[model samples]
Target: MAVPALDTARAAPHTRPAPAPRPARRPGRAAVALAPAGLALALGLWGIRRENSMWRDESTTYQVAHRGVADIFHLLGEADVAHGLYYLLMHGVFALWDGGLLALRLPSVLAMAAAAAGVALLGHRLAGPRTGLAAGAVFALAPAVQRYAQEGRSYALVCAAVVWSTHLLLSAVANPRGRAWAGYAAVASVTCLLHEFAVLAVLAHGVTLLLARVPAPIRWAWARAASAVALVLAPLVIVSQQQAALVGWIGRPGQTELLGFLALTAVGLGCAVLPLRTSAAISLRTLALPLLILPAATLLAVSFIHPIYVDRYVLYSYAGFALLTGAGLEAALRAAPHPRAGAAALAAVAVAALLPYSIELRTPQSRLDDPMAAARAVRELTRPGDGVLFMPARRREPIMSSPGEFRGLKELALAQHAVPSGTLHGIELSAPRIRARMMTAERIAVVTDPPGRRPDDTPQERTKREVLAQHFRRCAEREVQGMVVLLYARPGAC
Candidate 1:
């Protein structure tokens, strides 16, 4: 006799239940995502100009972006190939508005907003809407995120690409189809092209696939997509290597960086071990833990042999941090006897804690040096026909950024203009030529790094110092936030 049908509907004790269906995209989804994007935009725009200040790096962006497209392409071949795309994008931005610092920085604000939205939607897909909103909010409020959101750099755009690509990766993992994987690969490749360090993020994505415990076929699909991204990035990697000296300044992680990483890792680990289930198919811990840790940890590890660890390089990891933090907050809310009150209290505490940092990030003092402030000082210290020199040629950035401030001051050691030469700073005259140029000036303005910086020992820099010391007397000096402006006159003229 046929055995009575085993209880068809009943679950086996050992086997997992079929995963709950993936949440269908709802009409409210856009609204949910938009909330965080709006918040990030508002925060980014709050002090976008930073008291009419721009720093050395931002000045670089301004000068480069204002160049002709052909010139930008020419410059990319020599240096900063990594930021080629961003420079091109900013070219378009300035072409349209040319609103000075506001135009220079608005793209970053918009890109960061997009990134925040991506984080929210990713969290919603993995956990729930509440978690998504909380995660996005956390990311927006993160001091680092706030800092970079207003920067005129590629980091924010790279962050947007990474986050959205990860969102697509989630979709591909859920569906495991060719089109889905292709979509993921396309965006992932762009992310890498934006900045090759984003390849670290792709590696983090691989760990995420493994943590997801997806089927063999899905694993292969992910691998194929990731490999394709790498293949597309190969040329950039090669070119950037030739320009490695650009980042040669990075050093092994310092104590403060190490401590911060460890503390954040501890918090992430705690969130990962929370007794909460994200979904039947994948856990929030699996999705976010690797995203949060792998990119940073790998960079930190590699820095021992070759120090390339900069916190901004892995800023996308903040999305992961926000994701896990959101879950932890949600878990706390669920476990509390009064969820609404608990959320209110949590919100109040988070705002209070982050408010000071938020305000600090918008000030001119937030950056290493204010180029505008230095330029202003140069303008005030010297008259028309006076010679202006940068102690290290690189310090010319402030003058380059605000050339109007030093309108009639001669750049005594000049050769070619920066844009014409396709270099960050123009090629300086030889040491002998610079010294001879210095000898003729009646009064000179010199911009130096803040006191105690290791003095540039290059021959040209040495010549500048020697000429100034031997021939000129200090007439006046002013120390700005991160720069020193000094006026020198012929010994008798002083």
Candidate 2:
């Protein structure tokens, strides 16, 4: 008998109904999710204070968040508009409790914990309980995750939003409904607002939909949801683009970034080919593989023209890495002759391997520089009424967050305080004004990037250096991580 045409077969009766929008609730799933989340929270809290140290980036968060609401809003219009939402959220957090360092970092810790739980639940829904648990564990143990989990920045929260959004996107695809689509759009929109790079994840999700070959109607529903997200995010995109100088520091992808992506790409491809059993209506490989590679790959590609790729910008991709790893490990466990023992051994080995890295993350030295340490150095070297100068102006950040340390030391070139000026480092005097001011001081302390750092060529910075070198003698100098503190005395004053 001749087979019916493909279109005729599709139209024939008794076609399988689309799967339910959500997986059936299974017992112990909550417990499975909690295990990994708790682990992540514990790890996050482990070094939350980083020995009471905060780096330059965290100092920016602390100082920005400490400003009045109006000041923060005003600052965003001029710079850092991309981080506006996160800075506002942190402002609220600091308002509730001014517990200093702990308060600054707790939101990120909690956000990462939520991300861990979302990864687990997503894995469990797509694969099995074992895969879910393993994935969560893998996500929690990642060194990069641990590093960012304790940071005050928005990356951790952004990651959490994207991961949960991916799970919701899966729901919309499984059983296309108006409410499901709405939920996906709302969460996905929040993810992009948190950090614009997260919009790439939405593109990755589109690829997954195409690979799964959802019905035309479902595809259109997804398109609508994705469009809604874009509409919601459009304003931020436009505003942030006008302020694109914020990311000017980003450079073309380096060897480290290229090698890292290639290695993970190979691993993700390998995981996709592995034998696996999962409950997902569409293969987990299709979802996880695209999620793992697309966002970072797209950023890397774009960096060729304009360098906007930063690993932390697409940190949510690690959730995809964890899911693939979990599925692969779960499959291996089952294939072992003694599954329980093999799994236990595997856990032990992972812990052993990650322990040293975990310990290193908790140290102050792990960060680029300790802002507090630099502050202490400044405080120790300068006397009240002595003049203090920040070379290149931006070095003011290290001492800006700890005003008490530099109290009474005249800021020789500052025209206005940072918060009052609604700028990060505040306005500086003109070159002539700075030179005249330097002549009046008997002693001056200058904070600068450590020796061998390229000097700023700006007019203000050049005048500061020229006057110091020609008129003052270097009486004493101290080098701290990421900063140098030098005390200069007028000739014969030392």
Candidate 3:
């Protein structure tokens, strides 16, 4: 009996020294990881709440789409631009949710959060849980990430899709089974539709399969799936062709913008790869290389032909680059004979990077006075028979681009005023020109942004301000929320 008991004790699963208690997840790990994303959300919410005063580009989104979702769809089929799908999605979201700044901004917030979670998961899977956690934390705190989170744009969505698709790719490559493959295919298709840069994901996957020696059958399946996507996107490529002229107008960025873009790209990708530095040295560098190098090169090359050089056009690359950088950072630490020293150093650097961002975002004033409050205030001041001139309004015309587009300046103007009927003009004419033209009107608000240069200005357009002083016996200008609205009335007309 004693001998038998001895044998059982020796065979017990716990016999190997309690298997070194699993490393306690870093203290307050969940909270620490979540901090960055929370900060981003808070900042984003505060940022867009105001009379953002429709930039010319922003104005266009409103004009046509405001008519109805159906109208947006029709525009997409006819004269829509590269961002049509995203614009379409926003059109529906706005129509259903009332198109408030908060509502339009919510989608980007969700996307940014989704991206953070995906980064963590990818980092964990690529290296270990600890690595994943660290990478995710850094990503949430990145400044570039915060900037895009509040805007009603597609960059945040593209970022999320890229990170998530990468996570799916990790699973698919490892298992390459029905569910994994299906997930990969579905995500890839959606990503492609969201932004064409998603095609780079397929290349990344191919590299991963090659490095891992995935089964031949699985590789062949991935190839077929990619081929199907290429075929579907072929039409989009043709569309890209038509847009070439418009896109080409954006010349190679000036030196400063290019430098800033490169820095942000580095910061974004660095966060993604920092957590997964072990188990697969391949996870960080190799994955990031194709994403960072190829897509940028391709876009720049095409810019020569098609002109798609906006940073957001390749926003998806930021996620992949972050993952790669995180992996590299983690791997360098693990490679050390004593990883504790390297880990401490990494943790310190991460803290340093995140602290500034956290502080900047926590303060709303730094982001600027609440825009939403200002917009609402302006609306209240509006009264019937009052003409509000958007002075130097031509620059802001892009924000309100179409005079009658759905989500553009027209909607904003209509929402606030009872302009039963009149043309909304974006002219350089001074207060006198406006006052003289609408002599019957009792009050006139000449609205315009600060001065900006133009290639050409009509002779009458110049010195209109000096001319206004001469014609309008009584003229007063007040800065209403950064807009110079000069109210002109006859000497006794007030």
Candidate 2: C-alpha lDDT: 0.89
- When 1 and 3 are scored with lDDT, the better candidate is 1
> Whose lDDT is greatest here?
2
Candidate 1 ranges beyond 4 A from true positions: 1-27
**For residues 19-114, what per-residue lDDT tens digits would candidate 3 score against the true structure?**
567865553435534654564465556546433433333444455445455555545544445566787787787778865556666898878887
Model 3 segments more than 4 A misplaced: 1-66, 77-80, 177-182, 203-220, 237-249, 261-282, 304-306, 331-383, 389-443, 455-474, 478-484, 488-494
lDDT of 1 by residue, 150-203 (tens): 999999999999999988888887888899999999999998888888988888
> Ten-residue segment with the worst summed lDDT in candidate 3?
414-423
In model 1, the Cα lDDT at residue 412 comes to 86
Per-residue CA lDDT of model 2 for 359-460, tens digit only, reads 999998888778788788889988888999998798887677788999888888988878778788899988899999999999998888887888989999
Give residue 339's lDDT in candidate 1 (0 to 100): 81
The clash count of every prediction, one per candidate, is 0, 0, 42
Compared with the true structure, all predictions reach lDDT values of 0.88, 0.89, 0.58
Q: Between prediction 2 and prediction 3, which has the larger TM-score?
A: 2
**Greater-lDDT candidate between 2 and 3:** 2
Q: What is the Å distance of residue 65 in model 3 from its true position?
A: 5.6
